[model samples]
Target: MRRMIFRRELKSNARGLVIWSLVLGGLVLMMMSVYPSFAEDAQTAEEMLNVFPEPLAKVFGMDTLNLGTYTGFYGVEVHLINTLVGSVYAALLAAGMLAKEENDHTAEFLLSKPVTRIEVTGQKLAAVLTNLFMLNAVIAAVSFACTGFADEAVELDILVWYLLATFLLHVTVASVSFLLSAVMRRTRSIVSLALGIVFLSYALHIMAGLSDRFDFLRHVSLFSFTDAAAIVENGGLDAPCAAVMVLVSLLCALGAIGYYHNKDITG
Candidate 1:
């Protein structure tokens, strides 16, 4: 039953995923056109680095330095933008994926199955993950192609680690959305709440960089740990910070499971 529900959900969503894949592909291509030049010479790399706001780097994982290599350029544009934006965008999409049906009362035929709600919710999340991974794979392919013309060898270890961290960030966002849907009554409210959390946290992260007054906001938003520059330089996870994110994500996932378990089937 869970499998049946998941298949239906994925089939329904296939078109949107295809559209998003194209949009992301375009973003990657646009970045590729300019990024290669940015790292083509020492002067270009230095200039590219300088254009980024110093404090803002902390919020986007810009602390890493690839030291004038393809990895460095990839980190600057592709990984960085996706780190800040992709994670949340994917989450918003996932959060309302299943819950929206319920909120709209379109889930009746599906939920009427003999399967338990947990199975349904869990399988739906799995489907979301599968879709998200496909998107990530598309993005990664473009990135690898862009970074292929390297003056220096590829840093596979570090690049993979950072991308993993970025993907985990998306998973966390999906969990948060799922948790929200379980409690929020209206789908409109759910969308606003999901997007609000992502955008608000992002705005706060930026504010934290610009003002000391909002400095404390750094601890709360996931974007604070997404510093692409830092990841590229280190080529791996920020152990302590990554752990904190995992814990928070676990809590959100658990909350969603618990809430759904007890939630009345009103939708």
Candidate 2:
């Protein structure tokens, strides 16, 4: 029964998963392809970035612009977009998985089966993790392959760490969205609220960079914890930030399980 539920969820969500993976992978490839051209006239590109106001530069992650190298250019150009898109994909997938059952008026029938709520939640969560894992794996492979387009050799170690941090960040966001899905009764509300949380977190990250007055917001925004510039400069995963993501993901999963196990699902 557990395997059946897992396979069913995976099959149901496969098309959406494949579409997101291709979209994200194509975006990463397109962005990485532009790196060689920028590297050719790195100084001019850097000077162009210098014309922006300091706060604006910081908000766009141009404060540490170094286009001469692959890692630096990727950090500036590709990382944030990749993070944003990947996080949104994760949130949407997680929220939709459970909530759709309720919204489509299928939950009553599903729950009437021999499956317990815990089993349903566990199977669905497994499917969510599997889809997230597949999405990240595809995009990471695309990003790694696209590095070959750069003039200089990219640092494989830092690239690996950056990708790992990005994956963890997606997991954290997806777990939170999953928790919301378990609590919310409507699919539309779940997706809307999930996206709202993502954009708000991103806004906080931008605000944190804009001024020290909002520096404290960094602690709350997941974006700050996964800052690409910081990851590239540090040359490894941020241990404290990674730990926080893992902790939050675990807690959210536990909360989702508890709530879903007790909730009344009626059509």
Estimated TM-score per prediction? 0.87, 0.96
Q: Which residue pairs in candidate 2 collide? A: none
Model 1, residue 218: what's the lDDT?
72
**lDDT, candidate 2, residue 70?**
85
Q: Which tens-of-lDDT digit does each residue in 3-56 have in candidate 1? A: 987897789778877887778767877876775555567675676667778776
Q: Evaluate residue 147 in candidate 1 and report its C-alpha lDDT on the 0 to 100 scale.
A: 64
Local lDDT at 177 for model 1 = 82
lDDT of 2 by residue, 103-175 (tens): 8899999888999999999999999999989998998899888888876767888788778888998999999
* lDDT, candidates in the order shown: 0.71, 0.87
What are the runs in model 2 whose C-alpha is more than 4 Å off? none
Best by TM-score: 2
Best by lDDT: 2
